[model samples]
Target chain A: EAGVVQSPRYKIIEKKQPVAFWCNPISGHNTLYWYRQNLGQGPELLIRYENEEAVDDSQLPKDRFSAERLKGVDSTLKIQPAELGDSAVYLCASSQETGWGRGELFFGEGSRLTVL
Target chain B: GESVGLHLPTLSVQEGDNSIINCAYSNSASDYFIWYKQESGKGPQFIIDIRSNMDKRQGQRVTVLLNKTVKHLSLQIAATQPGDSAVYFCAETKSSNTGKLIFGQGTTLQVKP
Candidate 1:
């Protein structure tokens, strides 16, 4: 069927403005992840959710970044008062792994944010 | 469109030739390793994966060779085509919190037609 879907394919905002990105994962996928990819760098994990519980979020910047995957299907990542350094592609991915298994991750086109 | 591997290492190959891209992972205890292909302005697509217990895995037209002794991984593309040109990434994953998937910087594959 359809793959993961993300909203606002591209966003541009001035520094210190608030920005938000949304994601809808594949159907029947139980795990979701949020990652940030900087220019010329690989995507880094920001938060991971299994169902509705956040299993990993150590990489997320709590001071300015926050994420929630309510209902275990769609997720939203928010950055308040965005900084110049916060400009990056926010990617959302989903997997079908259970328990301690690591399955293939299906990713979306990503929300590209540019902060000036 | 924005390119993904601006400062990353590159591998240039001719059409219909064999191509090999290598990566050195960080964790030796990682449960498994995976390969992803990402094109310009697109998300990464899964290519193949190999578990720690396995040294090799083959896909449609690709092969993944894992050398755990040196914590190295390689992806071999047979009869490489221009469509195969993209950024390749290798990631290591663990089951625990400390084992989040660590993605490599990615290698740009330039296939000359």
Candidate 2:
């Protein structure tokens, strides 16, 4: 069984440009999450999806960041007019279910974005 | 807002010696805790996990000790090896059924061979 997969392992863009990252979670997983990790910092939750519904997005910057999981299996995170501070690794994770605290998430290698 | 934090930013230990990493959490309601290992240019990998009810849990060569009273957590690596060198993180969650994990700053472990 393959783990979570993400596209464009690395991305580089100039400030004010648009950038997008894609993620494909593990099979049979019903919960997916998007997180941003900066240098010397842990990954912080940006958004969370239960199936196709986004249940948690309080931490997401709606002004420039948007995410969607149309079919519930794959997800895409987009940042329009990316800023220099937006440079970081975007990680995707998935779990079997949303059952309390028992769900163990499987994460992907993450997509590193560099905005100049 | 509750947060998780590591006591040290880095630790250096001999390959054959024992190593310990410490973390402190602000949320007393957190019932679940986990430890993760991350290497350069890769994702975090699960190492071990322990519940609030248990004080200690041991894996192959790693042990996780949880002190609910002080809201502290620690990971102990026995007979540490060079391969164990990586950034270790401790995460906590208050939602028993949700998968939301609040991770600590992380501790860089450098095993000297």
Candidate 3:
């Protein structure tokens, strides 16, 4: 089986430019997550979707960051007018809904964004 | 907000020696914990996991020890090899069923050949 797949492994843009990242989860996975990892830091949750419904997005910056998982299969994370602080790695992960919150997550290689 | 933290930023060990990485979590309600290994330019790979009810769980050459009493966790690698060089992270999830994981600042493991 193939792992989670992400597009445009690396992205470079100027500050205030718009950028988008795409993710395709593994087959049969009902839960998808988007996380941002700064240098020397662990990946932080930005948003979570459970079968097309966003269950958690408290950590997402709504003013500039937006995400959607249409059809409950693929997801897209967008950053409008990206800021210099947005230069980091964007990771997408997925897990099967086991009801016990013990599901193991599988992640993609991630999209590294560099904002000048 | 409560967060997970690592005791050390880096660790160096001989190829044939053992390596241990430590992590401290502040959330006492966390019920599940996982350890991940990440190489350069790659996503984190699951190494091992342990539940709050268990104190220790062992894999092929990796062991995860959880100390709920102290809110601490540790990963031990036996007969470490150069291929084991990577950043190790410990993550915790609460019982809320959200499946949101809080990860620690990772520890870089460097094994000398």
Candidate 4:
């Protein structure tokens, strides 16, 4: 039973460049989430997906950030024209279901992005 | 390495000592809470969780205490070890969001070797 897996453990890009991060959640998990963790701060929810549909994305920067979970099992987060302030760890987490007592989110080693 | 906030409230404990970390949540509707341990460069790992129904829950060597009255939560680690040192975060989830947890400001635990 492997945990969530993310690709390109680390990434670096310049300002105005586009960057993308990928995530693969745990098996049989029906819910997936993408979070942005800034230095010295806690992880903030960027978006959440239940199966292939995005249920929550209010926190995501719609003008520059976009995400998709085409098949529902894997997800990708993209930031176009990345800004210097966009540097942060992009984390992905998954859970068994939605409801009480099922709120434990299993997280993957995040993808760290550095924008110069 | 994640830069420590200008002045992180630190909790230093001697090896083998018992440690307690506290958190305050804002949302009253949040019915679920979780404790996560995040090592350097790694994602937050679940340490333990407690539902709003129960005031306290215990795991192998860890315990989570929740106080709905004060909207406070605490994580207790028995026989703390150096490996247990990391940034700990407490998150709350509303019963409606299914399980989207709103995380706290995080606390950094420093275990004195």
Candidate 1 residue-wise lDDT, B1-113, digit = tens: 11222233888888999888888888777868889999998889989988888999999999999988878888989999999999999888865432268899998899999
Order of quality (lDDT): 3, 2, 4, 1
After superposing candidate 3, which stretches have Cα over 4 Å from the reference? B1-6, B95-98
Could you tell me the lDDT of residue B24 within candidate 1?
84
Which portions of model 4 miss their true places by more than 4 Å? B1-8
> Which candidate gets the maximum DockQ versus the true structure?
4
Put down candidate 2 lDDT per residue, A39-70, tens digits, no spaces.
98888999999999999999999999999999
In order of appearance, the predictions have TM-scores of 0.93, 0.95, 0.95, 0.93
Query: What residue pairs clash in candidate 2, if any at all?
Result: A99-B97, A100-B96, A100-B97, A100-B98, A101-B96, A101-B97
Candidate 4: tens digits of C-alpha lDDT, residues A38-112: 998999999999999999998999999999999889999999989999999999999998764466788999999
List, in the given order, the native-contact fraction of each candidate: 0.55, 0.67, 0.56, 0.75
For model 4, residues B20-91, the per-residue Cα lDDT tens digits are 888888988888888999999889998988878899999988999999998888888999899999999988
Worst ten in a row by lDDT for model 1 chain A: A96-105
- CA lDDT, every prediction? 0.87, 0.89, 0.90, 0.88
DockQ, 0 to 1 scale, candidate 2: 0.62
The positional error of residue A111 in candidate 4, measured at the CA in angstroms, is: 0.7
DockQ of 1: 0.50
The TM-score of predicted model 2 comes to 0.95
lDDT of 2 by residue, B34-93 (tens): 899999888888898888889999999999999998899999999999999899888988
TM-score of chain A of each: 0.96, 0.97, 0.97, 0.97
Q: Per-residue lDDT of A1-116 in model 3, one digit per residue for the tens?
A: 99999988999999999999999999999999999999999999999999999999999999999999999999999999899999999999999873576647789999999999
lDDT winner between 1 and 4, please give it. 4
